[model samples]
Target: MSILKLKPSCKDYLWGGSRLIKEYGKEYEGEVLAETWELSCHPDGPSVIRNGAYAGKTLPEYISGEGRQVLGTHCRRFRDFPILTKFIDARDNLSIQVHPDNRYALKNEGQYGKTEMWYVMDAGKDAFLYYGFQREITKEEFAQRIREDTLLEVLNAVPVQKGDVLFIESGTIHAIGKDILIAEIQQNSNVTYRVYDYGRVGKDGKKRDLHIEKALAVTNRIPIVRKNSSYPHAADCDYFTVDKLNLDGRVMQKLSGKVSEESFASILILDGEGTISDEREELAYHKGDSFFLSAGSGTYTIEGSCDALVTTIREKAAQVRIGIDIGGADTRIGLVDVHQKLIAWKTVRTNAMRPAKEVIQEIGQTALSLLEEQGIAMEQCVGAGIGVPGTVDRKNGVVRYSNNIKWEDVDIAKEMGACLPIPIYIANDADCAALGEAAAGAGRGCEDVILFTLGTGVGGGVILDGSIYEGSGISGSELGHMVIVENGEPCTCGRRGCLEAYVSVPALIREALAAAGKELTPEEIFAAAKEDPVVKEVVDTYIRRLGTGIVNAVNIFRPRLVILGGRISEQGDVLIKPLEEQLRQGCFGGEKSGIPEIRTAVLGSHAGMIGAASLI
Candidate 1:
């Protein structure tokens, strides 16, 4: 049903009050009812589904049972459920603490970051709380205060009443005051760096440990001037957006809303009793109750006398990306959306003789034309990605060198950004092609992948854990340059016996010309190699060299997939079979370590463009 009511997980901390039992109808039989995790998916204290097809199940179980789409499109960007809601009844003041941002928390705590908003449901007459530093303080002074038990003097003490809102962003030191009941909407992360605990002993009769060093590293030791942002939102941050819902049963008995595919809706009822209904079913709700509505569930009505906080994810106008493929002769531009759909496409002739600035300008104009044709606004565009055929300084978005396009040390992204006015990402054409395969072609569903591109010259891309591996200094993954023979053949890279010298299409055609005494295309060479003994020897040597290279890559990276792309890949099983046998014979662990599956890329020529677009 639409209204999936939840049963909160209760905590019985030492400073908790029984107000949750006397007022909020909490059925907990513990010594204290400190906090109620009303809408939680964390493993430590998961909320239970009270009414639905998946009744009596944990929130995580319900999520798994209903597909991740239930969390909505915005949530899909997160690896786990994005938000957590809870009710806190603090009988005593909480310890002064701060939380880390995503980068710090993810590295140290192995979880997402915390940025929370608190709504004062009720508070004592003289209740007050710490907001942040009253004024700018030196790190040394802040540390000294904590050591001397004078931290409260530097903290900003603000008196609070019912219906007050305080946004506690990550790194802002804050604490809840005694005799305060609050409804908190926060990120899923539970990392907190406690600086002080008022010398209060825990159940084991020892003071709560202080993460002083960690707190110093993360805390914002400065006065916090709350911004009165008029975005028509209570808390409109990256993690979540919350809006207050005050319904009067006497006048308006029902509050209707629509949850689009963009975000799931959550209702945390703080007061009153009522029933939420939709086309599916009706659910009764009370104080301290929580309801989860899946995304794209269409229209729904909340019919009740209640005070609630409605939460949903706020998103950009669109998640579309601009993809550019800088080819030697023709450059292609495309617009790809979050759904991986190529919504708009265009192509322009590239005058390599023109200045790089003029050429880049023309490419940017072509992208705008595609958007106009599709009736898409530039504001809806996320970012732009360009794939250039050469070594690229991906970080600087500069094309270091491209033999195919005759470009060297060109700041492609900087020039394009002048017109596009969005973030620009640049990557090597081969790496982009490999990304395309991993995302939508043969390498899909695999994390680690190695792509061998055997065209005029052999080049490859190494993908580690779904991202391009540039190795040290953004100049690595030159797999085709690995020498397979001791001074056997000269290579374009000015090296002797390189794998590219033997396995590349140009190399094969040259070998066939020497043996068959006729210049021919790779296809014609392959056909002749099947009949002529002299041509067969050259073909066998080519395959054997390629097999050696493939085996070496497998043994080193141990990728889950090894894709063969370029013109040679068109042969499919003809090349894959012999390569597989050769790997089995020579590779140290191709079979025992589970030989990486060999597959031909499915996206073909468009792979470069598609992969570039995904950079957004």
Candidate 2:
């Protein structure tokens, strides 16, 4: 695929605290309003439309398949093909605001709400960003503070630095400080509820409307903040995997094999200039350029000058286990007795392939039948839980994108509930596994836990204080999509050098095949690690990369534990010992520091199924 160049789209606002120009004339004030690029949805922001006869149309029209053939897939799925990338130059502090997820939006605004991230381009000395409340404040307290105009006292302000990336999950009260530039990536939704804006006036000399009720409704009491951090550099999951490569001078990066049984990838050039080459083509890239590569593209190479950061997003490996009769054909439902002591199970069913109406009907019938056989009635089911393999508006149960299932904008929960009459909870499967591990598996009893699944690809789940943390729209836990290696391997998510591209099952297989000049299953390669020095070397390299990736997670999350699951976890000691050692040696925290404990997942194969079921 050819590279797509995204143009700069800016916003000029007379926001009370803007960075406009100085006075130019007696009647005109050259004050700099907040100059912004609206990458996603912001009611007051600009939208990016495809160039052509319908060029002036909004992004929603393009995503809804109004005209262009190239955008039909995007419109149907509502995937995160970031439309309007922006450069925000804040002159004064913005408002302290939070966004609702799709669920909140459906319940109130009747649309999907935006969830965004900011990459700091520049900041003044002592400049800070508003993140969460200073401490855990109750909903009532937060409401009262906003009502009393004392909310500023409770906000947590973090010092800012250039190159710092902040992941603002939905519902976290945050704002940008003065003299800063940021690149924002978000959901294609335009609903924001401001709790406070420093009591500033607009160009019209009026305060903006405050959505106190709505803001309080969605604001998270316990907001997490990680400072002075970079990308994960390596991680995985079904949706996307990321790797952060800090390159200086020249570097050679290669990616081969597969991350999942089936998947694709993309590359995002965050900095510097570089070229990616495959057997068929060579492409040059500069800062902010992105490209997509098919999963079937096999091995490839990237050689670049100066320093470049690349991120690869791809599919996670399929989890496996033996089992007897469970249920459903598409569900991949099965139960296997383990060691006559344990039972492992998995279920991978989706309605993405069928018509939306049919998918809803099929899921409803199957769920009802499954529940009834288990002596549980539909009414007693509490809520139906689903694990999608792609980007999802979890709050509203909308499957935004799923290449594996070929689904887009399907309200699986709402539609199914219409027929089944039950509350429904949905999330990414990897996130489900993370929550499962936290609730009843290896991370049991821990307040904070980060679960990593090593399979064909990698997936992550974050649990805090016994509750799964779903960001705005329930689209938060995308650990695998963090960039690690600059201009490294290609990923499925249309980025390059993501974690999945490096240490995933397919990546390991690729390395092994490259060394032995023959293809081998991940299992066969592991078995050979004991006898073949070459295989051991390859396995060691993977463990080292995996360890570095874990270090990144540790630095960012500071969890109480890091649990590993999925098929690759079957390698056991071969993967764990080295991983633990490397993490200990390479991480930022010293021994006895608040660094998290790293362990193998005890839930094994049933993790996903149990996690999926627990989502209820």
Candidate 3:
């Protein structure tokens, strides 16, 4: 029922033809109409609504007036409209160009990089387009070839025909061939770095500028591996998924589909003469027609012969993932929803003295009870992620060892699977906590982070590119085992002067007891440090030694954030401020690479459970 016809914004680039204006029936007064932005909300060239109550309003304006719910829940991930669809008519070759990836583009251009797919509608004889490089080329050779005006020599040119499809990822150097009419579906971005323009001049009678420097930085000089279209989909990528729809008036005169609440549907009429009807109303359609159907628009049907492309945002449902944080005293089970919120939780006594299988069975039963109370079925849950307080062989879902709960060589997944009918994943408790913090805690929005938990022992985890970075052998993230001193103090891990030996809660208490002649809790020691010189020295020394370990981590990973967790981290700024100062002075880059932000973990006890669930 909620369908709106779109009026395209025409472009008159020098390389464009008049096909869009003549054959496609686009109304443009320009000498040549090269491109038509069909379904766009981009500020550069927005499509206008031609029918319905929002007539005469640009797509962006309509979206603003109607609220983002019209875009559907799946679009919640995007800051703006997710895609830009266009019809490109190239009478001459487009400039050879490359698009930066999201990281680089956001830093340099303040926009997402373009990853586009082109569906060829028509092509002239011998039509060919430059893809990536024909072979791997060095940066020196690429620059030399560009300067010598021979870059095309090393480029991979592919012959094109009607119905041919090409997916161009960011950093791929490419150019559209002459005499090709194509439909392009791309990310909502207009940033481009043109490398070669074939001596073309703009309308101002001046040579168009070339972005050779940026092109040199982002271009991928390797041959691109082409892939065939998978059945039922013409092109599929993170940004968009497109499927071709064809209806022959005699054999297949009708087509029907339903747009669900997850995503909106875009119907781009290429060669079609049909009537499209939804639950509320029906409208006639022809070639070059574009329609935007809001999410949950029930069923839609098209009748008469047609050739069209259907595009939809195919994002996974944001379902809950069960997280179980196994501890020595208690097992905390929680349901972390799509927003990484601990929507529901329960705690049960963990009788570690009992057999591992018995303990796991209790934990599993507790999780099932929690789900039942919340009205969540096993099918609705993404899966279960368990955080074991020990070495975990994640590949095999085995708790290799756990000194906290005295678990050894336990098949956690198999035991838990007996009660929960879903996939089970396991990881070191610290690693799980770090993953949780990275996703929704202190390191939220950061892809790389390092978390150090200063608890009974200084446990830590490395999260690189948003995943727990457990290196080869699965014992690699034992951060506390790294030695910072030769023989200063003995560690529980039987190592001398390991980071844990110097800065753990017990170590801090030991230092306080040695200096103050009395045992003090971490909180009391921090409070007494304000007036007591001896206690201040103990705390400063603790900070200094911990800073050494932190500096070592920052130097190695250069993560975007360093998170301090565990109970001792409750010191907040008192701990982070001094450590940050030490890290600024002692880190490898000496502040030139920019210091990673240091912060205390905010998730409290739920970090482990939420992080465990994130494993799914």
Candidate 4:
């Protein structure tokens, strides 16, 4: 069908009010109408088609019968339906919670993460809600405050009014305050990591479970850097783009538009009554009405005064950069668009034991093969960046020294450039990760950022004033070599008490073996720390030492963001919370100077690849 009206699935949450039912005309048998899934394909609650031949069928069922084309060509990249629209009425404070990113949610929860926008429809006097943090806070302080029930003191309580629009990305800690109604459009996911519930109880008379560990893993512990609100469009991002429509009925009683093949259009009516019509069909829409217009439906017209949100998918660009992360064991290469989206990728084993020229040739050939498979031309590429695991003399395109790859004085760029058609650049793999994160991931929007890769060894990269701060010599910034202990553990760099000695994955496992008499994986060590005091001590010591190194880096560089990466970082909040505490205590000047936000690197394994691409 070209135009289909949707019936929402209602919810009777404990903190819900009746505003949606009384004011927005939502029909629900529940005593309290908390939320309405207006346009959704989520398994828990799906919107049903109310009119046309698809009436009584859920949105997913209709889409299945109509074929995927109904969703539009712009939606082809997605594995499932892309967006979910809802209406919520809060009579009391909702829980303080955080949503994970796609990588974290998909790995642990078997679903996509949420990135949502809230349009305030109505609010009571002095109505406010928690958005993020009032200021930068350490994971340690965040946990302490949660246990003390004082989290609200540090949260940024936004005083919202009707018509205000708030875009909440994944990882932002937020809650809806009492006496407010909101229209929310978000990714098609229901994953929420609730951190605090105001000690509230569920129907069973027990406090609702708080996902403290998970929340800590995902919550961005800093005030959101608000964007300029005077943009041409209402809200635009990778998932969906929404535009506001207003017709005064006097000066502009009618508006016309076309539903193109690129994207299907979703119309969420916020206020006023109107008649929406196409060439063959016309339907009356009131407040809270939801309508779906199939792609390529030709011209459509709307008459009568109305305020609405028109949402559609935005297609990605074809132009991309090639990123190559060269490790001793393997190399990961990918194509990343201007938006920093990784379009396609491939992993190839790196025979680093071979001569540098041969390895570079293989990597270059692999990149070319990937491009050919993706139907990409050399002209479409901006350039290629290579992340080498070693001391890289970027200016001369040489690998000065790399113990892992057993390469020294090798011309990586020159060798690779010979086989690839694009210009080539190279840097330390750790440095690439820092650059990638600062450019597009957790450290985006921050001028000064630091990244620590805590895997087999502690590796680091420093971005100061929007550029990598390579020291005066070709030795590069060996942040992991900085001494933390007076004469503690032996480091791989043949030093005593360097940060790497105590903070790396091997270091943690070593400590566990010494203290607990059993060797364990990083995941097992963290899990055991919850129950085994012996393992807890080992983990605590690791965090303490890790914090010491971070404190030293922060004092010297004064960065705004500190990112934790590498394999060990997968522990998430289990690793971050305690480490943040030590940094808070040991950091010079403490809160007097703004504390840098400590976060887990969101780019994961692709950080090196994306970071390498940023060199272009």
**Each model's C-alpha lDDT?**
0.85, 0.61, 0.88, 0.87
lDDT of 3 by residue, 1-616 (tens): 2898999988899999999888889989987888999999987889999888899999898888887788877665565688999999999999999998765675477567789999999999899999999999999999999999999999999999999999999999999999999999998889899999999999999999999999999999889998875666998866788999999899999989999888899999999698999878898999999999988787999999899999998774557788999988988999999889998999998989999999888887788778778877443565789998878899888988888999889988888866664568889989999999999998999989999999989888999999999878866488887899998798898769899998899999999999999999999999999999999999999999999999998888889899999889999999989988998899886878889899999998899999999887
Question: How displaced is residue 461 in candidate 4, in Å?
Answer: 45
Over all chains combined, what TM-score does candidate 1 have? 0.61
Candidate 2 deviates by what RMSD? 22.2
lDDT of 4 by residue, 287-367 (tens): 889999998887999999999999999874565788999888989999988888888999988887788788888887788
Output the lDDT of residue 439, model 1.
Answer: 80
The segments of candidate 3 whose C-alpha lies over 4 angstroms from its true place after superposition are: 316-616
Q: Among these predicted structures, which one has the highest TM-score?
A: 1
Clash totals in order:
0, 61, 0, 0
Residue-by-residue lDDT tens digits, candidate 1, 460-509: 88899989988777665888899999987999889899999999988998
Model 2: lDDT of residue 564? 85
- Give the winner by lDDT: 1 or 3: 3
Say which prediction, candidate 1 or candidate 3, comes out ahead on TM-score: 1
| lDDT string, candidate 2, 1-616, tens digits | 2222222234555442333223111111434545544333344554544334435554444434532233322121222332333446676677788988555674466545555667676689989989887889998898888889888888888888887777676688898887776655555556789888777777678988888888878888895765445335433222223444544543444433232213333454555676766666676666554444433455556666423223333321322111111122255322212122213233435445467678566655555444445443221233445666777787777988866667788887788666454446677777767766776678777879888777767778887776677766547677776778898889777899888887788888899999878889889988898899998888888887778778888887778888888788877777777777776777676676765677788876556555665554
Model 4 alpha-carbon miss at residue 471, Å:
60
| Runs of candidate 1 exceeding 4 Å displacement | 228-231, 316-453, 456-510, 516-616
